[model samples]
Target: MLNYRLFGDLSSSAAPLVVLHGLLGSLDNWHTFARGQAGKRTVLAIDLRNHGDSPHVAGMSYRQMVDDVVAVLDTLAIPECYLMGHSMGGKVAMMLALQHPSRVRRLLVVDIAPKAYPPRHQALLHAMVGMPLGELSSRKQADEWLSATVKHPFERGFLLKNLGRKTEGQFYWQCNLPEIARHYLKISGFPTTDAVYPAPTLFIRGGQSDYVADTDLPMIRQAFPAAELVTVAAAGHLPHVQTPAEFTVLVEAFLG
Candidate 1:
């Protein structure tokens, strides 16, 4: 099972919202947004397997990931809940809704489509896997090293969130880098499924991102007949992070 943090009143009449983060991301990425919605609805932010405080395992398939989510929900005694996920996590949410439709009330998939994606994160993965944690004296040095492959400072900072200090000066990655790198292909590709989840679904895309293309709508509609697509203006892949206020409004309205 994955480690999760709960916000708001779980006993409230409002249906609980479960959030799953993207690849190389943890529950912490959604902390602020979850906290913002805590007053109105119960929110559960989870660290998927191999990320953040969750148990590190070998297999990184969508099936295994969905099982981990189910385990968390089962332990919480939550029969069903609203699910929101980003990037790779969005794919997980889609799979879960298909495999166990009864467990999902509403679905929100952010900046991803239910189709196979070409290998795009290999360079980033190589940089992350090749980071010399033992040689790094400070997070700044680690950032400098990553900057060789990761050009964007913001992205480097985001990836640096996985850096954890074991001792006073030594830093190591909290994520299971080796396993993720090995299963990169699986992570990039969506698992084959003929199953359809006949529930209300929302696909939120970033206007600046190519992750969700016009070609994906037909597939999305075929799987989720009631699914609707919305785009966040001036936002990229991480729309929730870039345009949080707008994102929150969209979510609250849809979930309501």
Candidate 2:
């Protein structure tokens, strides 16, 4: 099961919003977005399984991840919620809405499509697989090792969040690295389902991102008939990071 933390008081008469992070991303990434919308509604930002403070699992797939999300909602007794997610999380949001439409009041999917994506980060995956988890002395050592194979300080830093040390001084990764590496194909592919979500849905794509292209819109519409496409100009995969003001505006309007 995935470990989760609920933010804000649910008893305060605030509508609930559940936010999920991307692959290798923690709930901390949504801190700013969650905080920005806290006044409008209660926020629940979860560390998806195998990431953040969540427990490591044996394998990962859209269906399994969606079930984890549903489990969290069930624990809270939340029959429905406004949902938002990015990258891998976006795929999860899509699955949840499709497979559990009665549980999602509205869905916001950021920078991902329902279509199968090509394996673009196999090299990065290979490098992560090579990391000597048992030999790492500290997070700094892991960073140094990852620096040799992973470029982009921000990306390296994100990956370093997974590096952790146990009380016995044994080095390990906070996330299920082995499981994720083994399920690379499943992770990149969309699950097959006849379930179509009819609820209001928004596909917020970054203008410079190849993750969600015009070609994917057809597949998105076929799965989510109510989905509307909105592009955030001058942004890449992380639209919330590059275009916060615009992103928040769209989100607010959609959720309102």
lDDT for each residue of candidate 1 in 163-199, tens digit (9 for 90 to 100): 9998677899899989999999999999888999999
Off by over 4 Å in 2: 134-141, 167-170
Question: How well is each residue in 1-256 modelled by candidate 2, as lDDT tens digits?
Answer: 5666566768864559899999878888888887887568888999888888888877798888988989988888788889999999999998998888888899999998887788877787778788877777677777787787787777788777666778999877677777787887888888888889998999999998888888777878888998899999888888887789999999999998
Q: Which runs of model 1 end up more than 4 angstroms from their true locations? A: none
Error of 2 at 210 (Å): 0.4
- Model 2, residue 60: distance off in Å is 1.0
Clashes of 1: 0
Residue 236 CA displacement from its true place in model 2, Å: 1.6
Write down the TM-score for model 2: 0.92
The model with the greatest lDDT is 1
